[model samples]
Target: MDDTGLISRLGDVVGEANVLVAADAVAGYLVDWRGRYRGTALCVVRPATAAAVSAVVRLCAQAGVAMVPQGGNTSLCGAATPAAEGRSVVISLARLNRVRAIDAANNTITVEAGCLLQRVQEAAAAAGRLFPLSLAAEGSCQIGGNLSTNAGGVQVLRYGTARELTLGLEVVMPDGELWDGLRALRKDNTGYDLKQLFIGAEGTLGIITAAVLRLFPWPRAKATAWLAIAAPETALRALIALQDRFGPALTACELVSGVALGLVRKHIPGPHPTLVDSPWHLLVELSAGGDEASLREELASFLASMIDDRRVADAVLAQSGEQARRLWTLRESIGEAQRIEGPSIKHDVSLPISRLPEFIERADRALVEAFPGIRMVTFGHIGDGNLHYNQSRPTAGDQTLFLAAQPQVNRVVHDLVDELGGSISAEHGIGQLKRAELLRYRTPLEIGMMRAVKEALDPRGLMNPGKVL
Candidate 1:
């Protein structure tokens, strides 16, 4: 059987309209949102249900064709994009967007793979619950992609990562077997946790069709503050103070660099807030069961204490929900601001909270010395130690030249991260971007163990080929 035969067979399983091969129709499926990865696909298949997905996978697997499971195509590392070979069939889960069920009593929601993250959040909110996995692309990113990458967003400090929130998953195995593991039980230690393997596997083992996600009680009140700190050390002190004072109510603690803020202010339109000029800033928030006024007063009191200690140089407290959103806009727009600024090497790295200050100082010193005039745009979820440590080309340097120096730049930053006990890729999975770097950082034995698991689950190596080991 050839590509035509497979396409026809897939059409038979799904409708012919769902099997898209036109240049315009499949264009978006071939490339990543960052435009860093571009690939060719024989066709893009849209399966509307788990059973249909199983049929499509069975046909493709029997035809010896590779399958790339894609959702939302919002991957920072090109995890959801097909390879340049163009021989694979991109199994898009977009048509599977649906809310399976919501069990408010059990604090769980079962959602299909293609359900937009924002949609899931809205559904939970409508049911008087909170689904806290939030990211800049939540409006466009899908639940399957979130689970596949084990996404960690701004609220990870309080709610946890996608893996921790996911209670069960429905996966279509590489060989076209359907594994219906969508059990919403909070505790079932029967044996090996199978759902976990597929959660962060980046679709190598199987295609996630649906998931049962954990939910929480909605916060009755919220207090948001934007604190201007002198440096990362000052930011750390503020984090400790906020955690000590508010405990779990301290939901988010984001660190943004002055340089990063400048880009957002310059490129992104704003009624942006006015604050004292500082080298670094911390976007802090506290949400708990109380009235808004009292929460704000408590947060204001804590800010006052910080001001006396000089840990916080200046602070701006949001008096309303609208103001809080504007503050969040500043922090969330860093990536897009960097995008509009220009192309450069990007690192989604994480370090121990205590080691972050040292890592930043050492890495900054080393990178500047080596790259001479490189621009750093850095910010991240301070509570979780994940930093979106990105770089831009020198003010007048050619983009091509700066991009070519990526490997050398990576060595400098990634080497230091390893030295300080950090991760090369944090929230972002080890997709095509970090495939080579994974071997460099991980031991051969560790890689072997991963390979063994992949082999056992997907012996033919057809599932999301050429990604994550």
Candidate 2:
């Protein structure tokens, strides 16, 4: 498709300088964060407002050209990356970064789509409320991308995913019409909940321009702890005990394998935690609106009990805010550390909480038998049954040769994921990376319903084509 006319119109709507056509200017936007997918874009446009986004989309629709909505360009699944074959326009939402409103009484924050997740969290904190949606990319990832992917972070055990925290969304439909559904009400059952279609659609159905997000009371005190555990089963026992004792106060439960933690220690440049011998570790946190000392004392007591039962080999409780942050840094740095270490096959799968031990035991044995000397860097929000089970090269080899086994590796992991009655994707949406896997795992009827909605909203598929469905 010829994008010259559409390009000029987009420039007119968003301003001439906002339209970037130079290869160097648009090169960074065409590639995903993981350096996995690279594509071609005719031009990159920066729209600062919802109106500009609408006009740009309309122009693209009129010219029969495709558009890709990009925010922060931090998509691990290449959802924000354009198709390598198509001359699509990349709509960069970075210019729309703004906090539009914060209703403290209503406990809601209305932010433009391009606002970073960290900024939203800061805004909520400034209002004495907490926007609990967080992840490793929160520092760079935009709220629009997070909503589009339905991001789940460490605190998901308590606050839930982006879809749950989101109250409303303002979307730019594929036909260039803007739908202002930014209602912050908790209960609104008038008709079809249109926002749900666009949230996790990964911009295939529409482009999310702004959002009204739910907020919560800020935790006055929090106690963080790290446990050296023998196995996933032991972690599960500790998880159950924490849930029974702390209940809603149990905010985060993370599982980190020794190899995964070693990567963070070796590459991330920080003092690693003291528990070095254990093969598996659990990082957990409890937050409440109470005194700090009492909370830590309670957690310490629980840790002692866990040790007595031999479920925990050792435990380290954070003594101060700095200590707690250091503990969190360890859990959050796994992804970056993995990137620095080398290329690996990644899987973000979820299973029934009760079946996690069995899934891990079976998957590990199966993978080792298939690919000898393969390194499994496994960790995730075990509280929510999500595991970031990744496999890396054993010691040293051509990166290309190791990566060639990706398809075969995925089959071994994903086939077992299917057999265990688990989902292939838990947090990340079916972006380009998982599109084929999505088709292979999801039932035909479920996919049909999804396609029906996509067709109804984006008939020509001009909005972020070649992504998701």
Candidate 3:
């Protein structure tokens, strides 16, 4: 399509005010949140409604101009960012924010894709329920992006990922047809089950406009604890013990390496409330709709036994709700702390929970041997076997040279993960950054099947092209 002509057409479809073509105006949408990718877009279009999204998509498809669907623009893997060539038009779903319905009895809330993650949580809370997909980016990340990546957060141990929290979706297919599968049905044995296609497609197959998300009962009783563990394996053992005692009430169990905590203390401004000597820490939360005193007492008794057995080195249970949040702040600050430390090679990989400790030990040893003085920050939901295994700059090497070896470093970490029946990209989807790695790791047969599905839904390949499949 002619550049000027296409821009004019898009402006006509969504109005001039919604169509952004100026370089300064479109710059923010071009680059990714991590500043790792920069793509040029002929323009960026903002549509306020599902119908507008369908129309703009249809217009772009007919013009043969590639389009990118972006929400919140918080992707660490360049999923929401455009390519360096900037040949496509970035469509921002931020203006499509709307809450369609909320059924407390059915335990579902229908919302537009542009609504921020925190807004959804607040809406659920207002309805006397909870949307348990809590994450550090909850204040800024959007729901559409959450579903597109099948996001896993601190609460995934109990409530599951974005995939589990979702019931239905309203997507604009690549061909511009609206798929109205936004039903609140608990069980519908229909053929094909099409809604699953777009959930984690990263906007490759279609653009998610809205979703019907599942909600849970708000917990009345909650207990949070910070434990100093001897090792990762010990943390794993304590996890099993706590699960046996607390059962379903065990909501979150996160592993935090001392190295990561060190970064948090160094880069982030704080009093460093946690002792600097603990080798590893576990942030454990138990939530229920029962008596708070009973839950706290039970957890304290369990921890005392664990300490006696040498599973836990030392521990501190939150004495009040504010203290519990303070404990969680340390866990949540790791990402920001790393950001301040400078660009590093990161891998959000996951393995079988049974293989987690071994995977960590081996991967750390291998990376350290290959890249001496490389600071390895290993921490994540050990209960789920997902580790945000990241490697900081070596104390001696040139920063540019070290970053240039990301692909090789990724191979070392991902190879071990693959050998242990793990995924290279865990909660994060195969966005633009990992698209090539995904192709390298996935079998040809699997890639063929994914391509077939993508072609079946988006034959024109105009919706979020150059992403996942």
Highest lDDT among the candidates is held by which one? 1
Model 1 scores a C-alpha lDDT of 0.93
Could you tell me the lDDT of residue 91 within candidate 2? 92
Q: Over the stretch 323-357, how does candidate 3's per-residue lDDT look in tens digits?
A: 89888888999999998888988899999898889
Q: Give the best candidate by TM-score.
A: 1
lDDT of 2: 0.91
Q: Give the candidates in order of lDDT, highest first.
A: 1, 2, 3
lDDT of candidate 1 at residue 377, scale 0 to 100 = 92
For candidate 2, lDDT tens digit of each residue in 136-157?
8899999999999899999999
Q: Write the per-residue lDDT of candidate 1 for residues 343-451, one digit (tens) a residue.
A: 7689999999999998899989998998889988989998999998999998998899999999999999999999999999899999999999999999999999999
Question: What pairs collide in candidate 3?
Answer: 39-83, 40-86
TM-score (all chains, Cα) for each model: 0.99, 0.98, 0.98
Q: Which residues of candidate 3, in runs, are more than 4 Å off?
A: none
